[model samples]
Target: MKITVLSDTHMPRMSKEWPAPLLQDIQDSDLIFHAGDWSDISVYEELTSMGKVHGVTGNTDLTMIRGILPEQTIIEAGGKRFGLVHGHHGKGSTEANAIAAFSGEQVDCIIFGHSHIPLLKQDGKCLLFNPGSPTDKRRQPQYSHGVITIDGDIHAEHVFYDSKS
Candidate 1:
């Protein structure tokens, strides 16, 4: 299964629509995961047109987004468990907080966003992945997202580009 991962889109605040690269990835994937900060529910509707979407709500999300998405979620695909979170705990580092969110959980991977800083690393028994922000890169030089291919094992990769569209 090929899963496209993204987060912190921030919608009209960041861009008018999905970035070209990310849109293509969404079209070419088996599933899509948004770690949150979408800001608008229209973003969710747009993504659903491409494929199945699994997501969480972020601190910046409004009532509609929060009503539809959870603070965190767990999904099983290709025999692997994925934990998704926005990592905005109204506190410290997003990465560290994300890890803590899934602490003691039985997940093979923890996917999160909130910092707009791309990250991919192993944390104890789980793979810690942050797809960054495709439409809102913040101070980062490139806009980015992630793709996870699951065969017999799980493989996660970050896809970065110089432009959002």
Candidate 2:
């Protein structure tokens, strides 16, 4: 199924709105996954209009908001097993070894967002994905944000959006 993947958006603090490019992807997607660090649930509410949204909470997600999201999420979609998490204890800001920790979940795919970086790779039997931060990009030269699609083949593409007129 087409999945609009996003993560690590600090929102309102980093940018005013969601990226424009992502809107198209979200519109075309059958489902949407937001890895974490939303800063507010309003973003999640807005994105749900795009499609079925599944999300988790980040480290900065505050105690009040913490109860709203689970640290890990598991979903079965299109005959695929999906494991979702914010990847907090997994590792530091940006670390491969840290992300690898989720590889052991025995899921067909693991979707996570932490460090505001997007990554997609075939690690063992699972496709690990991170859509990075749409709002809180921390100066990564790529400065990118994107989504992941899984059907016959696997895809992880960068989606740049213009939130301003």
Candidate 3:
């Protein structure tokens, strides 16, 4: 199953809209995972037009968005367990601490976002991902989104779309 991973989309604030290519990918995906910092619940609703969305609340998300998405969510995708969080618990302050909290949850991967930094890393036995920001591309030049391929070999890729265009 191919999963579309997105994060730090500040909606009307960050970027005007989701990239057309990413939106198309979402429609073609088996599932959609949003890391956090959506800033608005409407963003989730809009994204749902693409596919099934599983997400968490980021630091910038309002109370309502928080009500909808948990601080962390554990779900099964592509025959593997995944833990998705907003990473507001300290910009991934301690990987061990975050993983420890999710240790007994039976997860094979951990997906999180915050700091508007994109990351695709293998931490020990799990894959940790941060999809960066499609809008908040301050730190890095890559205004990006993420794609996770789970059919044969588990893989994570960040697709940096030109924000200017």
Query: For residues 1-165, could you state the per-residue lDDT of candidate 3 as single tens digits?
Result: 899888888887866777776776787899999988889878988888767899988888999997888888898877888899876674347344356658667777888877677877887778887787777788797788889999756799998876623
Q: What is the C-alpha lDDT of each candidate?
A: 0.91, 0.70, 0.80
Q: Which residue runs of candidate 1 sit more than 4 Å off their true CA positions?
A: none
> Which model scores highest in lDDT?
1
Per-residue lDDT of candidate 2, residues 1-165 (tens digit): 787778887766776676667766777888888777888767767777767888887777766557777777788777777888878764454445335645456678777777666676787777777777766667554445666667765666776543421
Point out the higher-scoring one by TM-score: 2 or 3.
3
| Candidates in descending lDDT order | 1, 3, 2
Candidate 3 colliding pairs: none
Clashing pairs in 2: 20-161, 20-162, 21-161
lDDT score, candidate 2, position 152: 61
lDDT of 2 at 84: 80
Provide the global lDDT of candidate 1 against the true structure.
0.91
Best by TM-score: 1
Which model, 1 or 2, shows the larger TM-score? 1
